[model samples]
Target: MTRPTLQGHLDGWSQGDDLRRDVASAVLALAAAGIRISELLAAGPLAGALATVRGHHADGDSQKELDVIADDLVREALAAAPVALLGSEEADEAVTLAPAGTLAVAVDPLDGSSNIDSNMSVGTIFSILPFVGADSLLQPGSAQLAAGFLLYGPQTALVLTVGAGTQVFTLDRATGAFLLSEARAFVVPETAEYAINGSNLRHWDGAIRSYVDDCQAGTEGPRGKDFNTRWVASMVADVYRILVRGGVYLYPGDARGGYAQGRLRLVYEANPIAFLMEQAQGAATDGSRPILDLIPTHLHQRVPLVFGSRAEVERIARYHGGASAMPERSPLFGRRGLLRA
Candidate 1:
């Protein structure tokens, strides 16, 4: 079957709604930005120079050269878009772009910037929300009108969801256009693979530790199934793998300094990724709770993000719930003392 172009797929939708049109336009703009970035990345020498750290972003992360360029490119592309406000990880706060516009866009213009040095996969993530009020930007994922990620991997692809379903569009380098590669992409409900930073096992909370331990135990453990583990460190790469196959990815809260709230940003990362996961018949959560139900207290609020196949996600949630059933913490001996008591 001839896969439809992204624009064609969008065009097939009923067109009376201004919001829908705006979203379609925004997607096209993003596609344009992705294509440009992909081409630049193909130029090895230039991309290497662009990978140099220029400074640091508002979030205290190292600001690479490509990060600045990509952010500017996306910002410019969406300048005349029907987007009222722009929220980005690189920005200190959300900025009003078009006061009369009805959509607000939150984006991680270049996620996993550090991966550029190693020639690993990196991508851009975006979430669209209604611009009812400034506070609407702080709304939960359920309030999203659309969400997507533009992955600049071996092949540039855009994974998007507009409430109805999730679809993947691969960029045709020759045509400079995104074509629908997967319509209503479905994720298998279970798998023997998992993704997490196992090095942080010592700092991880009981729930995450227990879950990892169970997986590590293989068929000899309670799961009665052997498992394989992988961690790409880059979320877009990790999530893309999960979407293609089936596995769980975790970036959970831990005992490390400034990590209690977890590492990944809620607005730009968790919400948008959660939107895609649920649409694909997958699942996403922050340990015991659903990621989409989280109310954003801040624009760049960090949260523990765990997502993938529904069964695997639910199993991890059960481990979290089991932790709650354990004895309460104590001032004298902490979790250990409570358990002993």
Candidate 2:
């Protein structure tokens, strides 16, 4: 496949002018709303209190900062045309639409909220799925037609798609528009250079532990390749790294309480990331299940996340496989066979 340079991709942005207009407008809206909340935290008193829980936020507590930001962004994003329903991770119900369009956007308005207090990078992940059939806001993940995420960081970038290829757009401060950083038909590498979080080794399942063990062993392990590990405690940061350089990023389940399912929400985190992975010729899964196939049942539903380079992820899935699972075997000796007992 012919690979296009970043500039070449930017030149093609005119092709999807309509979406560009809608999404571009949404960007401004996001900024206007983001500035409001980010400014709030930037002020006194509350800032000091939030800084206490900078890296880690206790669950069931007041995430008021996140709540306001999410509500604002969702309200603004839904204002765009072709948006039918609004589903927010922070909201208790699926917001209905007028008789406009049948497109539904599921948004994680404030992802990595804990990072907000610490001045760490956070992001907004949204999946634009079909709202035509079944009329279910609690529908399956397969219904997604498009997905994207906005990283509010050093160099804020927007990664999005509408079923074609995923594209990365950087916010050009001077022009106040998105300039393309990557074009259609991008390729994410097979072997990974980095993985995440290994300290939970004792609590991890045998499969997860074995996978990391192999990577830790690197070239000496089953696969003759060097590897690295990194964990930023922020999904946006990890994803940005993987997108910039090719690597596998995982947030899987361990025996730890509240992590048995997953830490990140499914509707926002997994769905959008899954879309981006597939678009970039990478992969996304919940260990054994394809992320796009799962459905959301609760407001803040969580699921295992394993995505990035295709081959490495498939291998990880093998270890995760049990009865009636996908491909069920890790390449133990660089060959397609069952794991040695």
Model 1, C-alpha of 180: deviation from truth (Å): 0.8
Off by over 4 Å in 1: 322-341
Ten-residue segment with the worst summed lDDT in candidate 1?
332-341
- Name the runs in model 2 displaced over 4 angstroms: 1-67, 80-82, 97-99, 133-135, 185-187, 323-341
| Best candidate, lDDT | 1
State how far residue 268 of model 2 sits from its true place (Å). Answer: 1.6
TM-score of 1: 0.93
Which candidate number maximizes TM-score? 1
In order, the Cα lDDT scores of the candidates are 0.85, 0.67
Residue-level lDDT of model 2, residues 1-341, one tens digit each, is 34443334433543566654444344345444544444444452564454343222335434545555556756764676556677776666667653455566677777776676566777777776655643545666766666777777777677777566888877666655556677653546665475667777788876776677666666665556667787888787778778777788888888887889868888767878988888788888998788888877764688889988887778778877764432234565443222321
Residue 254 alpha-carbon offset, candidate 1, angstroms = 0.5
Query: What is candidate 1's local distance difference test score?
Result: 0.85
Q: For candidate 1, lDDT tens digit of each residue in 209-252? A: 76776676666655677889989988999989999988999999
- Cα deviation at 141, candidate 2, in Å, is 2.9
Q: Which ten residues in a row have the lowest lDDT in candidate 2?
A: 332-341
